[model samples]
Target: MSQQTKSDYVDDVDVDDDWDDHPTDDELEATVENLEASGFDVEVVSDAEEALDVLVSEIPAGASVMNGHSTTLEEIGFDDYLGEGDHDWENLAADIWSIDDDAERDAARRAAQTADYFLGSVNGIAQDGTLVAADLSGSRVGAYPFAAQNLLLVAGVNKVVEDVEAARERLHEFAYAFENERAQEAYGVESYPSKELVYRQEGTEGRTTVVLVEETLGY
Candidate 1:
């Protein structure tokens, strides 16, 4: 299947555009500080290229890597990079997709949660340092809380919100609409927030990193 960009679904979805605006410098800095205080290693990048570079530099060679569906990663060119880039890491996503049998492929997906590095994007980020994301199935969030040995979350500043409640509102009212439309277009199936995760703090040290790009990206 071909990769779809945000432009492919943006016109079909109705959402409050304000939720997709880049945060002010003060808001960004405060959010970074709070995220750090909450035990999440936060990296602020000026643009998508810088974010991609940081993402690439985080993982070591030969490690098994898997990622959930993330338009932000595609926007930054990481999806194509991981799929075709010259890297020694074991691309579990590619491996899982190559499976022919339905049951085997499903099992591979479940087993991939333990991949050395699991990468994905967050739907909403609260300035208070909570990360909110939802998935029609538990595929994406299943690795975020603790399943994966390490997690890499890449998101644009547009995802930042006032608090956990605001984050959830953004997810339910804004991100969900865009995602549902995208799902219908891509998979010919409707999507919903059937599973949601509210991540407040990380107990494991150096196990998770949040890359915040200054540009507006993803839902």
Candidate 2:
């Protein structure tokens, strides 16, 4: 399947004009430095394809993989790749969704958080190295903070904010409206920022990697 592009739904929602601008080179450099100092490995990619390539190459064969719902992931083709593309890793998302029993499926989701690799995207990333993310459910941000063995977050440069407070503001004032429209269009329901996560630092070294793409993507 072809990857879903931002152009499909971007025009349908009201995105904050302030949130759409990419960071300056100096800003990007500072963000990267702070992220690395906070114990996350940083990867800067020129485009979505390179971001997808880096994401794919980070995990080894036979590793168990799971991901939360992320428009950014879909934009970069990771969702389709993990679901239908040729890959050697154990795709836990596929397995969990195939279950017939609701109870079992819910249990699988909780357990899958500890998969060898957990991938998703954040709503806002502070220049000071803080990451802000929220979801209608805790499915995505839940795995980001120590639940997963390894975390891989992919985001556009537009997500970078001035500080943690601004990151949080961006989540509600900027990302939520766009995400709400997306939820309505795709699932026939509205989305809310029900659960939030503010990631300041990683205690374990090399456990998380943030891939920042040059192009704007997702909410």
lDDT per model vs. reference: 0.92, 0.90
Query: Which predicted model would earn the best TM-score?
Result: 1
- Across 122-173, the per-residue lDDT of candidate 2 in tens digits comes to 9899999999999987988899998999999999998998999999998998
For candidate 2, the per-residue lDDT at 108 reads 98
Give the number of the best model, judged by lDDT. 1
- Write model 1 residue lDDT over 8-43, tens digit each, in one string: 877888778888877778988999999999899999
Error of 2 at 117 (Å): 0.3
Off by over 4 Å in 2: 1-6
